[model samples]
Target: DAGVTQSPTHLIKTRGQQVTLRCSPISGHKSVSWYQQVLGQGPQFIFQYYEKEERGRGNFPDRFSARQFPNYSSELNVNALLLGDSALYLCASSPTAVYGYTFGSGTRLTVV
Candidate 1:
């Protein structure tokens, strides 16, 4: 069973530019969540979607948004990216009815 996977292990962007990160969940899973991890900090939840419907969201600004597809894959979109937005974007997923979560290595975004 393949675990969660994220693309563009590293990225470089300028302030005000937009970026899109991708994720694919494990087989048979139905929930995908996006989190942002700044340097020296834990992952901050951005959004959670189950069965293509948003189940929860964190305190992130509107610039941070995400969506899950029918195949259980997901994409996180950040608009007007700032230097503070430069961080590790993590993708986590779990079974539709499970508790523990599995996280991807993440896309490291560096906004200059």
Candidate 2:
């Protein structure tokens, strides 16, 4: 079975531009969560969606948003990107809340 996967692996953006990052969850999984990890820091939760419904969200700005599709894939959209927005965006999935999460390598966003 394929694990969670993210696209691009790396990204470059300018201030005020928008970027969309994609993620594919593991097979048979229904829960997908987004997290942002700054350099030298742990991944911080951004959003969580289960059954295509918003389950949880972290303390991030409105510029950061995401949605999970019917196919269990997800996309994170960030608008008005700032230099501070530059970070590794990780996607994690789990069979259920009781299970541990498996994370993707991440899309490294560099906002200049």
Candidate 3:
């Protein structure tokens, strides 16, 4: 089976701009999670969607948002981007909410 895939593997934006990142989960996985990994740090959980409904959210600000499609794919959007938002955004997929998460390579966003 194919692993999770993310689009626009890299991006550059200025502060105050907005950006959207896309993700496609492995076939048959029903849960998707979004995470942000800053340099030299572990990925921080952002959002989780199950069955197309939001199941979990992290300590991120309102500038962050996400949605899951019926096909199990997902997208992460950030508004009013800031330099702090620059990081590698990851997409993870799992069959359920508990374990077995498979992650994508990530979309690297560089906020200048």
Each candidate: RMSD to true structure?
A: 1.0, 0.8, 0.5
**Candidate number achieving the greatest TM-score relative to the actual structure:** 3
**TM-score, per-candidate, Cα-based:** 0.96, 0.97, 0.98
Q: Name the lDDT value of residue 71 in candidate 1.
A: 94
lDDT of 2: 0.93
lDDT of 1 at 66: 89
Relative to the unseen true structure, what is the Cα RMSD of model 2?
0.8
Give candidate 2 misplaced runs (Cα > 4 Å): none
TM-score for candidate 3, please give it. Answer: 0.98
lDDT of 3 by residue, 1-112 (tens): 7799999899999999999999999999999999999999999999999999999999999999999998999999999999999999999999998699999999999999
Error of 3 at 7 (Å): 0.5
Candidate with better TM-score, 1 vs 3: 3
TM-score of decoy 1? 0.96
Q: What is the lDDT of residue 106 in candidate 1?
A: 96
lDDT of 2 by residue, 1-112 (tens): 8899999899899999999999999998899999999999999999999988889999999998899899999999999999999999999998885377999999999999
Q: State the weakest 10-residue window (summed lDDT) of model 2.
A: 92-101
Per-candidate Cα lDDT values, in order, are 0.91, 0.93, 0.97
**Runs in model 1 lying further than 4 Å from the true structure:** none
Ranking by lDDT: 3, 2, 1
lDDT of 1: 0.91
Give the number of the best model, judged by lDDT.
3
